[model samples]
Target chain A: MEDNQIKNNSNESQKASANYDVVIIGGGPAGSTAAIYAARSGLKTLVVDKGLTSGALGITSKIVNYPGIVEEISGAQLVEKMREQAKLFGAEYISDKVIGVDLQSETKSIFGNGGVYNSRFVIISTGSMGRGVRIQGEDRLLGHGVSYCATCDAAFYRNKDVVVAGNTDEAIEEALFLTKYANQVYFLSQTERLAAPQELVETLKNHPKVILYAGTKLKEIIGENRVEAVLAVQSDQHEVLLSVSGAFVYLQGGRPVTDFIQGQLEVSQSGCLIVDSSFQTSIPGVYAIGDVLCTHVKQVVVSAAEGAIAAMAIEKEINGRSRMMVDWSEKKQ
Target chain B: MNSVIHVNDDQFEEVVLKAELPVLVDFWAPWCGPCRMVAPLLDKIASEYSGKIIVAKVNTDENSQWAVNYRVQGIPTMLFISKGQVVKTQVGALSESGLKNLVNDFLAGKN
Candidate 1:
């Protein structure tokens, strides 16, 4: 009995030192569902995300179309419930932005803002980013004159003119921040009315340094090496040229946030990660799901189903056979 | 004043600006949803970096002097103060690990 206890203690220590069986790289519905399935199957799982409110689902105001829930629920509330369910199943969660990843080896390595983590299976469900203006020369001049993060890149355009495209809360906030550094800030909203909060809208509209252009569509971001001007069409269908050094876009449409693992996976033109019916990517032991995957529908229900499929597929691949077999005996031995 | 110190107008100077370690000031209000979310994160950060940093909170409703002085227009604004000077300021709610990264980056002098 003493020898058996010693063996059990050693086994527990070894298990504690082993890496997680699966590491999910997003905490949306898809990743959380995958974590639930994987952890319930007795596999160690970890879900790492940038933050609780970083994903698109996190920012969605309301979700009334999701089935089975009669009353409308906030997107954040739904995500929180999913996260709690995943935690109940014994899946560990970390709120850290993944900076780098290497999935070629037996044990995948994920380097995040917090620290390094290793897992046997890597699931890329990083979801999508805010859509960008897909105009001509927009992609060619990303860093030279275009920027997404006002906090990170706003200082570069000090005492110069800049154009902010979009009418959301983030755009208003970034435009407000730009007023601190730029000489004049132009806010071009595609729609006639801005869709931000009342307080924020009032502040930006009344600001002396801001120039509001309603019902404007971005025709092109004109420049060679740097952003020299922005060609846009006003509500009257008149083309207007705004000479600026930087143009920031914050559109509403979804664009996959797969920059961290672009070359590592087989991604479609729209930035969606391609996967087989089993949710497995081109690489072995690697899977993609949720808004990051190229699915016909990007609803929560579909993503959750895909996550379950991927988790079962991963279990079958790792355990060598299905665990669905039952043992029956007519007589006791 | 154990892990997360609640500083008012009177104790602000001594507990935050003149403290031995770097201080993180979280300016919050009770009505703010994001502030409520970030309050626990600040507590976790305080416990994690006990010796290296100090975390403090100032209720903007009760104390408007510091808020006006810093021109804080929003709730859930965190100010990183070191050597009696405000170094970095972020306005929004961050996750526990995200807040940890900010503290680590500040300690490493990267931000």
Candidate 2:
């Protein structure tokens, strides 16, 4: 009976409508920053999340580059501080995983674990997740040899021959890191030109232990029960065999996780949210921010700044509407 | 809390349609998964572009008439209106940059 009541209450919350000034999704840096700004601006804002801790920051061990921090700090600690600050400013935090959104209406409806929330403005700060490599025997040998994050698994392959497949800056960076511990690091790039930054390209070129292969695609990760080697095809149309003990396959490319609203909101070819300078989507009262956006850069600081900007914009909009209401009332009197 | 504007159909025309800046209307409904994904993104954009744009949301399930008038066939639909004219319509979840580019284009009179 109690379970039924809880379920019924959850359903009722979805149906019981109350208009909020601003509703923020995600509690990461971007979402937290937006909440702080919105609450400070005197907006009745509500922030919802699935208790996923910090976004990417949660996974990082040490963050040395963020501004204002004198000494190095853990990513998790920084995120905790940000959360504390946002909460202090009267930003309502709710533990809920959002399942749907209604952006076509005058009042936006957000459906989630906590039920439904109606708001004048909605902001999407949900970031992207890492993609998995699709290959036979890869899933079964995930823990044995196949890995994505080099930092997490680099120590396991110390003094062993390892292969890293990718062409982006991240891939190159990971390969360089692997070179620190591995006896030999095979950096495989599917394209002729290295897609990494110039500095990384120079470093990879100079490294004696690193064998940079251009126009080579990883065909399969071969191993009996553990990763032993990887088969590849060179640009010269020749099959090349590379022997290694461990393999790191980086699959950074994938469609955005916006399939939930198939026909609801405007999405780009890459599955990113399409917004204007004001961060407004095709639907009114709806906004988007951070890496989820279709932009050139997907840095953490940039996304946080976007969140702050969105909060301030919503505050001004609310103020403008109220002023108009007051003026009309005075005129009537 | 002070900045909040409780607007309904009765006052939408005056509070949103007749506003000075471009009005961004978010048409959303409950039980929408993508809408949930895009909610925080919208909030961030609203705060970022505060003085430049007007952001608001409409619940389609409650305000069925308004949703029908706009021909909203999906959840989380966003409409960009400028000077009382519907300038652009986005039909799916969008990223911050994606939405910002469109808003910038609208602000720059690019339509």
Per-model C-alpha lDDT, please?
Answer: 0.75, 0.69
Q: After superposition, how far is residue A1 of candidate 1 from its true place, in Å?
A: 64
Q: Over 4 Å off in model 2, which ranges? A: A1-17, A130-255, A321-333, B1-111
CAPRI grade, predicted model 2: incorrect
* Docking verdict class for candidate 1: incorrect
Residue A205, model 2, lDDT: 77
Q: Which candidate's TM-score is highest? A: 1
Fnat, 2 decimals, each candidate? 0.00, 0.08
lDDT of 2 at A154: 57
DockQ of candidate 2 against the true complex: 0.04
Write candidate 2's Cα lDDT for B1-109 as tens digits.
Answer: 1122335666678877898988788776444444555566677767777888877777654565665566554556677888777887775555556778888887788
The model with the greatest lDDT is: 1
